[model samples]
Target: MDLGLKGKNAIVTGATRGIGRAIADLLADEGVNVSVCARKADEVAATVSALEAKGVKAFGQVVDIADAAALQGFVRASAEALGGLDILVSNASALVQGARPEDWKAMFEIDILGAVNALDAARPHLEAAAGKTGDAAVVLISSISAAEAAAPSAYGAMKAAQIHFAKGVAREGAPKGLRCNVVSPGTVFFEGGVWGNVKAAMPAFFEQMLKRNPTGRMATPEEIAAATVFLCSPRSAFTTGINMVVDGGISQRANF
Candidate 1:
C-alpha cells in the first residue's frame, strides 16, 4: 500500500543498526529522503549508502545523542540537506538498563532528552513542511518495558517518560498540522544485537524469553519499523498521542 510518504524528509537517530536502521531503510523504501546519525563514522556512511541505493536521498553523520550540541546540530543540518523535515524518529538509546545512578542518568540524557532535543531542533522545519503539505509527524521509539517492568530499570522509566512526553507533544503539535506518537516494541532480535548476544552467551535465558512469547519468538526489527512508519504515514493523519505496541503478544496488557 502507498504510504503517501513519497518525497518526505526524515531524520532518524541511531540508524546505524537494529530497529533504527530498519525504520530508516523502510522509509527510504517508501520514497522518503532520510538523514540518520550514529556514533560510528563507518556505520553511518554504510547505512547512508544503503539507503541511497533505494533511490532516495540519504544523509548520515556521526553523532552522540548524549551530547545535546551534536544531536541538535545533526537535526538542523539534516533539515537543511533534505530541504525540509516531515518526519522525525527518535530511536537512539543508551540502553542502560542497570539500576545504578549513572545508568539512570545516561538513559535520561540519551533516551528522554534526545527525543526532546531532536523535536526542538526539527520543529521549525516540521512547521514549514506542514504549511506546504498539511501534515508532519514524529515517532518515538519507546519500549514495552515501560509498562512491563520487572525490576528497577532506568531504561523502563525513561521509555515510559517518552510516551508521556509524546502525548503532550501531540496535543501541542496538532494545531500546527503535526502528529506525535510512540511505538513501544517488545524484545526485538537482530544480528549483533542484545538478544542475539544473549542467545549465544546465555542459551537458557534466551530460551526462556523465546518461550514467553506466545508467538514462540521475539519480534524482528522490521516488524517494529513497519508499525512506526505506518503511524508516521499520512494515511494515519488522524493518529496522534497514541502508543502503538508492536510486541507480537509478548506483552499481555490490554490497551485501555
Candidate 2:
C-alpha cells in the first residue's frame, strides 16, 4: 500500500537507534522527509546520513528530549529543515531499573514529559501541515509495560501514563486537525541495549511472557515501526487517541 506519505515532513525523537531509528527509516522509505534527534550527536548524524542516502530528505541534531527548551529548539529546527511537520514520533525514553519511587520519577521525566514536550512543540507545525494536506499525526513509542508491570517494574507505570498523555494530546489537537496516538510495543531488542540484559538472566520472565503470547515470540522493533509508520501515514487517517498494542499477545492476559 502506498501510505500516501510522499513529501510529508516528520520529526522523530530517539531516532538514532532501536525502535525510533526503525520508525524514522520506515517513514523515510515511504518518501517522507524526516528529522531525527537523540542525546548522542554522532549517532544522530550517522542515522541522518543513512536516510539521506536512501533518497529521503533527512537531517538530525543532538538534544535531550527531557529538556523542554532543547526539545523546542530541535522541533523548530526540524520543522524548518523539513519545510513543516506533519508527523511527530516522540520515542525518546530513559529507563531506570530499581525498586524505588525515585527510579519511576526519573523515568517519568524522560518517557512521559519528553513525549508531551514534543507534542507541545510540534503542535502548531503539525496543525499547519494538516491544514495543507488534511493529514497529520503524532505517534508515541510507549511500551506494553504501561499495561503490564515491567521487569524494572517502575518503567511500566510511567509508560502507561505516556499513553494517557498521548490521548489527551489527541483530544486537544483534534480541532486543529492533528491526531496523536500511542504504539505500545513489547520485547523489542536493541543491539547492546538494556532490554538484552533483562532477557538474559530472566528465563522465568520469558517463560511467563511466552505462555501468554499466541505468536510465541518477542516483537521486533521493525514490526512495531511498521505499525507506527502506518499510523502516521494517510492509511490510518481516522485513527486517533488510541493505543495500538504490538505485544505478542502478552497484553491479552489469558489464563491457561
Could you tell me the lDDT of residue 217 within candidate 1? 95
CA shift at 214, candidate 1, in angstroms? Answer: 0.6
* All candidates: TM-score: 0.99, 0.91
lDDT of 2 by residue, 1-256 (tens): 7889998999988888888889999888989899999988789889999999989899899897678898888898999988888999988888665659788777878888887788778888998988988879998888877766536577877888888888888888887778989998877665556556556878688567666667877777789999999999888988899998888776765422
lDDT of 1 by residue, 119-222 (tens): 99999999999888889999999999999878999999999999999999999989889999999999899989999999999999999999999999999999
Error of 2 at 87 (Å): 0.6
**Window of ten residues with lowest summed lDDT in model 2:** 247-256
| Candidate 1: C-alpha lDDT | 0.94
Which candidate achieves the best lDDT against the true structure?
Answer: 1
The most accurate candidate by TM-score is 1
- Which clashing pairs does model 1 show? none
lDDT for every model?
0.94, 0.84
